[model samples]
Target: MSSIKVECVVKAHNEIGEGPVWEEKDATLLYVDIYGPSISRWNSLTKETERMSTETYVGCVVPRSSGGYVIGEGTRFAAVDWEKRSITTITHVDTEKSNTRFNDGKVDPAGRFFAGTMAVEVRPTELERKQGSLYALQPDHSVVKHLDQVDLSNGLDWSPDHHIFYYIDSLKYMVEAFDYDLQTGGISNRRMVYRLKEDEGIPDGMCIDAEGKLWVACYNGGRVICIDPQTGTRLQTVQLPVAKITSCCFGGKNYSDLYITSATKGMDEEALAKQPEAGSIFKVTGLGVKGIPSYSFSG
Candidate 1:
């Protein structure tokens, strides 16, 4: 375990703050409060945060190559112009599963948006039900269903070389790797690369570093850990001030800062009282590492 200083960058107290995307051109951080179903932007230079309420649960937001954002909202994907607060539909998926919504997603090296879904209301009885799936939205607006039977489809990213795709199905407590086809945006040869212990917390959202290590936010564990995916060995751990750490991404002047998002969605009043920082966005510096720039959606 490495002792690192964590600072709360935003204290908005989001019910479920999940996605954290850094826009370099604007020097701002973009994230979504899934429960609020709003997209927010925090300016690094001004220290001001602005939010735009959406009509659906906005799970993730990625900059679009054409200007604006490609957002995953509920079962539909839309293009959002933050400046004008306008949205246009791209497509709707898996309409049969009305209870599921997009959870976490990212733009691939080839500029395609890949995201997954989870049951909107996770209940004890639904624990064993495989009610989720993963999909990829191509540059031409076509959607592809890659995986089914996912209980909670949370994080997705690619290896530095773009040959391996790493993903998290939180309900399985495993981090999986697939042989990636960058040119075709296809994934195969799926295998488990890392599995969490019962005490390590449920794996939620994840991102890859410049050196190829995977940083995973642990829900209910109050920590973010660096794991070597090939060997399944833990490299470093960042203890957080609050539990329910939902997601993380690297963003800063040099891309060395690790931005973390957390949640207070299911916490009781007493739990929230103890961890007021829950649902706040946190940043960790001095790790002496950098992350690759996140890609933007081509369409």
Candidate 2:
């Protein structure tokens, strides 16, 4: 580990900025402003941002192997062609629960999109009812339910070798590991790989580094903590200017830069005033590491 430099790269004050994915082909970062209900593409060098509006809450976005992006649009899954600015509905999820919405997600090694949902209203008793679940949208356009009884489904990623899956249900204050079969897209043997103390903040979105370490964004914790899944131990922590750290991904020319997203959703005016960078996109460099390139959805 080395001294890392964290800086705010984009100053867009997003209410809830989550789900960051790197588009390697374009050398750009694609993320969603869930509250803005918009998709954003940021060019690191030029610092210019392009936004595409969505009809409802946009939880996550990933590149499609064919073209454009496959997004979790509101209560349904859809495909967006940036060039045409057109969105085509792929499928709808949890239609019976009008209050539930898609939150954080990522494409698995097998090209399946794994996204989870959370309730819009964060009441403690309501959350205790566990109004969330994790779903895997296959390359064939089929959706499969993996886990149920989730409170706040959040961070998700896989081990570098594709044999292990890592997920976060934020309200649980822990990260779960699953035995993943890439060939069949099956997950089993759910176990807690890491647990956070209440004071450490809840685990939100995460990504895996090349060395097989899980880098998790700590919501309301003001940092991203790197944990070694094998031993369930903390490795390093990268401090940020904001407390509502939502998500992160590795991008840039060399794939060593970590791009982080934050939120300003639950802060008071006094708290927001003190942390002006609460909703900005942050970048952490100087860590001697690299990350596996994010896979695009093949469907």
Off by over 4 Å in 1: 1-3, 123-128
TM-score of each: 0.97, 0.96
Residue pairs with colliding backbones in model 1 are: none
> How good is model 2 by TM-score?
0.96
lDDT of 2 by residue, 1-299 (tens): 47789988999889889899888877789999998989999987678999999998888999998989999877788999998999999998888787888888899988899998878756321353487888989998999989878888889999989999999988779988999999988999999989997667879999999999999999888889999999999988888888989999999877999999999986889998999998899999988889899998988
Clashes of 2: 0
Instruction: Give the range where candidate 2 is weakest over 10 consecutive residues by summed lDDT.
Output: 120-129
RMSD list, candidates in order: 1.7, 1.6
Q: Please write out the lDDT profile of model 1 over residues 1-299, one tens digit for every residue.
A: 34567899898789889889989998899999988989999998899999999998888889998999988899989999989999989999878877888889999999999999888766411454588899999999999999999888888889999999999999789899999999899899999999998877999999999999999999888999999998999899999999989999999988999999998887789998999898999999988888999999997
Q: Which runs of model 2 end up more than 4 angstroms from their true locations?
A: 122-128
